[model samples]
Target: MYQYDLIDKEFLADRSAEFRGQVARRLSGELTEDQFKPLRLMNGLYLQLHAYMLRVAIPYGSLNSTQARRLAQIARDFDKGYGHFTTRQNIQFNWIKLKDAPEILDKLAEVDLHAIQTSGNCIRNTTSDPYAGATAEEVDDPRVWSEVIRQWSTLHPEFSFLPRKFKIAITASAKDRTAAKVHDIGLMLRKGRDGTLGFEVIVGGGQGRTPYVGPTINEFLPTDRLLSYLEAVLRVYNRHGRRDNIYKARIKILVAALGAEEFARQVDEEWAKIDAARADLPTAELARIRAAFAKTPFETLPARSDAFETAKANDAAFARFVRNNVKPHKQPGYAIVEVSLKAQEQTPGDASAQQLEVVADLAERFSLNDLRVTHAQNLVLPHVKLDDLPTVFATLQASNLATPNIDLVSDIIACPGLDYCALANARAIPVAQDIARQFADLDRAEKVGELKIKISGCINACGHHHVAHIGILGVDKKGEEFYQLSLGGSGAEDASIGKILGPALPADKVATAVDQLVGAYLNVRNDGERFLDTYRRVGLEPFKEAVYAQAD
Candidate 1:
């Protein structure tokens, strides 16, 4: 994890002090709601359905034990006992009082964390693969580049009042776990043939009223020139993106209005002007940043742990944890353990204060003090030892944080829909809970194989519905909430938008429809094929027929 430097510490402390004053003014009515809204939002405070929601940034979703524990404290003292982990790899406190927000920011600052750029019209949190530094498949840790973007975009004078909110996601893994294709800008890190890591830049990718996959702007930008090229992209968007209509203001719409080739040319032309005037980032600065993120101490051990095997042999619970909670790590005898937030009947991503504290304590005790937040709305203990798996699982179970369904059906991704969000058309949390309950059988979920089910309250794609193997988008028809299903979508090495499954299903019929769809996939899939692959090979007709056949 990247530690804050002295300058960073001073900057955050100053910002926190400023925010505290702003909060006091708002409470005294010196700053009206109209005046304070933007300022509060800029600091990641939202007026939600029930109360204020304070979103805290977990830059590139990386955290150490101290940071995690601070989050636990915030949940305990300021808000309710739990926090919702958002799709942007950030955490949200849903019950924050307007008066207490500044105090919460103070606690966050104690751990070098703040809420800046988590929301409002400027560049938002930059998300990357949760496994960035540790993945065997990455060209480089995308966080290295993400940190650069964070520095450039935070409070950049020119971009603060852009036409609409902006989001950027970067990923280094070949599989695209971060869903880069649907972000405002997506950067895929890759090493050139000359063995230098740069990025394959994609622009205009976003989901909202309009959904778009980013078009490739540069095939192989030199590693050192990333910031320069990004500046070019932002400069173009900041200049030309619509301001007349708020609805039409996103960079995605602007890029689409101009063809991809022309957009690329515009960025290239901008880059040429800037690149000629500015020199490459100094070698020393790069080395300094790189040194800050250099790998944590990794101890070598046997390929597989005999103790882990013995535990698995004796205990079914440990066996389940080994099966689902664990991911292959780059270092021997180490495994990445996913702390599942999608426990049955709870909000999909809510982590109680006690649970958060448990994870923090476990990270400090058993795993390395490092933590990660996945784009799929779960936390990761990225450096857990195989020897400590049983103890960790037991501790997590006691905290109601242990559910051995990392990528399984119960591990759903859903937005804070109509329940809290002002823009949402329907409630997403209840639907997610219903589905989790519907597929409560663990063996049944596992037997069905890997399937990605994403839900959005509306077409904003906050839940990333467009890229799931089974995507559900809620819509309002004659004032009633209904769901439209899509089949064959994926957010991976082979990303594709899903096709709709004919007609919308009523709220009551949704889980049953999903059941039919999953049943159809399981019945027809050929050997060793996942849902997306099977759907791609066989098409939506099979699934659609199964889902709607009852009507006939």
Candidate 2:
């Protein structure tokens, strides 16, 4: 929804042109693979197992239909027929050619999109709640702060090339949909004592080798001082974070070693030295940014849509979809419609070029020309008219994008795994596909209710397996693929790392083990309890027993 200003357009043009020259030199033998590695990474290009991968950043998960159409075009022409939407709310093209990379970047720049800061040891995409402006629960739109951080952190001289890659997620809602706690820096927007807006800053939250939920560094950092506080935290991490061991290089490790109190003290000391006014955004700039995100022209209507209710009452499928895929909007007669990419037996987040185009068209027609990418690998038409639900559903159904399995077991989150990523030890997509096929019954999936199954190829936790209700990690055992399961994990406000159930199961046995675990949950769950609620209430013993019993 935020239009690119002249400066923004100029910056992208300049950056794209510069990258084009760099790419030309690399392709012409002036730069070897080793020489081009860092350069390519800086621009979000990765040489995967089969081909080069290009990750394009969708800032704070917001994009216009024009941008969406451009992405579809890129998926159609440049790389493959589809693009993978990631947990970071970014898009990854798996079959990118090194030679076509520059042209792709240029094309992205045309639509005010690029892969800048999508990779390397800098602040990655600053994500926020997808329902930012649409949700009524938020204190303020987190995208306002997210954009501020994005503009400030992009190519900042002091924080570039940290000990490890840094991530920052912000959310204003009481419900933490952004997985804020798993980021290197998590900014929870809140109102202070006098009703003034501020951030409850959490530092050192990460989920890789050593999973950690960032502890609260500042109980209340005033809105104006956000940048200054963030600077102080980054400065502290940069000064003392591990450099000798890449595994221990993340800020989370530093925070754990030093303790939260000491980390907070250090950040405070650093904050005291810096001139806050100099680092903080000016009022004019803040106002300008806020103005860009002003509310859309939502019509004044009654509390409920008669047409929507009538359709829901008439059609079972529509009713089921309404129950699962449609979310309440802050505006009356409007809905936040989730376009699920996780269809039965499909790769979780893979959207075909045609599917992308269809979504773009739908967004332009129904969602005020704005679309949002959720952290859960789903797309959101954040402001769809309730009366248009049937038409929207029919269009999506035709395109195979209307999957009513949000937060269900079959609605899995999975990484590229051995299929595309070089770091992966096992194939995650096939495993996810198997599980989805096993539980293809929509009624059965809805009965299971709100189960998040996240899969990762390796411990890198790209799929955010660390925070799923049911976490699966793929490991290589003597050249054979094995799947390890974890339980009681969540990425919500009550964020927690999953606990391992038992030994890793063989690849072929994973689906059976998952079924057994689900059965155990159903057996032990209380009335109206979801999988996570049941897991939290009963602990992992029941599920573990059920799984191991099947093995025995």
Candidate 3:
């Protein structure tokens, strides 16, 4: 985890102190609700349907035990006993009181975390591969680039109030775990022909009322020129992106209207002008940042140990966990363990205080004290020694956090739909729960394999239904919940938007409909083919025929 410097500490304290006064003025009736809206949003507070929701940023989803503990404290002291971990790798406390927000921000500041840049029309948290440092396939940790962008974008005077809120996600891995394609600006890190790691910049990708996969503005951007290139892209967007219609105000709309070729040209033209304005990116700066993320001292070990194997043999539950929750680590003797938030019949991504505390303890004991929250809404201990897997598995099993279903059908990504969100048309949680239950059997789920079953209550795609291998969007049909299905969509190296299957299915028949769809996929699929690959080969006609054929 990156430690906050003196400047960062002072910045938060100052920002909180200023916001405290702003809140006082608002609550004292000196500022009306209308007047307070933008200010509060700037501070990461949203007045949703029931109550105020406070979104706290977890930068690049990295945290220490202390920071994790503080979040547990906040959940216990202020709102409910739990908090929702979002797709953005941020945490949202749904039922927040107006007056206590500043105090919450103040508490967060103590741990060097704050909600600033979490909302408003500025660059949001720079997400990356959650498995960045742990993955063997990484070119470099994407958080290195993420932190660079974070420092560059925080309260940037020029781009503060753009036409729409901007998001940037980077990934160093070949597989895209961060959903980089759906961000306003997506940076894919790769080793270029010069043997130096650089970014493949994608622009105008967004998901809301209208979804779009960003086009490649630059195929290769040297690490040194990253900030300059980003500034050029933003400048182009700020000058010409829609201001006439708020709905179409995103850079995605602009890119769509301009066409990718024209958009790339405009960005290139803008780069020549603003590239000179950016300060020379110091090589020492990146090194200093990298040093902050240096690998902690690890105990030397011989080839693979027996504790993991012995546990797998002795305990079926632990075996399932090792299969689902544990991932290969970069270090010889270590592993990446997922503390699943997707337990059956429970709300997806909701971690109670006790669970958070247990995870923090396990992170310290087993993972050298680093905790990461995945974009998939799960807690990860990125450096667990293979020798300690049994103990960690047992402890997590006791808390019911050891469900070994990281990328399975049951490990669904969902948003706080009608239950907490003002924009939701129907409840997404219950539907997710139903889907999870429908595939609760471990063997059956494993057989289904590597499917991204995502749900959104409405068009915002907070649940990321737009990127699912099997996308399920909840819609309102005469006051009843109906689900619209889409297939062949992906958020990885080859990103493509999902195509809708057909008419929406009634809520009651949704799980069965999904079953039929999956069954159809299984029948036509090649040997060991994933859902999307099969869909691509056989096309949607098979899925459409299967889903509608059994419509009762």
The candidate that achieves the highest TM-score relative to the unseen native structure: 2
Query: How high is each candidate's TM-score?
Result: 0.97, 0.99, 0.98
lDDT of 3 by residue, 1-552 (tens): 577899999999999999999999999999999999999999899999999999999999998899899999989988898899999899999889989999999999999999987888888888888887888889898888888888888999998999988989999998898989888999999898779978899988987788898888888888888888888889989999888898998999999999989989988887887644345468888788888777677778755888877778988877877887888887888888888899998899999888899999998888888999888899899999888988888898888898889899989989999999999998889988998989988999988888888899998899988888999898999998899998988888878889999999888888888889889988888899988899989889999999897773
Tens-place lDDT per residue, model 2, 92-116, is: 9999998999899999999999999
Top-lDDT structure, candidate number: 2
What TM-score quantifies how close candidate 1 is to the native fold?
Answer: 0.97
Higher-lDDT candidate among 1 and 3?
3
Q: List the residue pairs that clash in candidate 3.
A: none
Would you list the C-alpha lDDT of every candidate in the order shown? 0.86, 0.92, 0.88
Provide the lowest-lDDT 10-residue window in model 1. Answer: 275-284
Indicate the worst ten consecutive residues by lDDT in candidate 3: 272-281
For candidate 3, give the lDDT of residue 361. 96
lDDT for each residue of candidate 1 in 1-552, tens digit (9 for 90 to 100): 677889988998899889999999999989999999989998999998899999999999988888888898999888878888999999999889988887888888889999998988999999888987776778887888888778778898888888888888898888898888878888898877788887888888777677777788789888788777888888899899999998799998989999899999999898888853354566677777778779678888887888889999999877887788888888888888889999899898888888888888988887778888998999988888888888888898888888988878878899989988888888788888999999999999888878889899988888988888888899999899999998877766577788888898788888888889889988998989988889989988888889778767
Count of clashes in candidate 2: 0
> Which residue pairs collide, candidate 2?
none
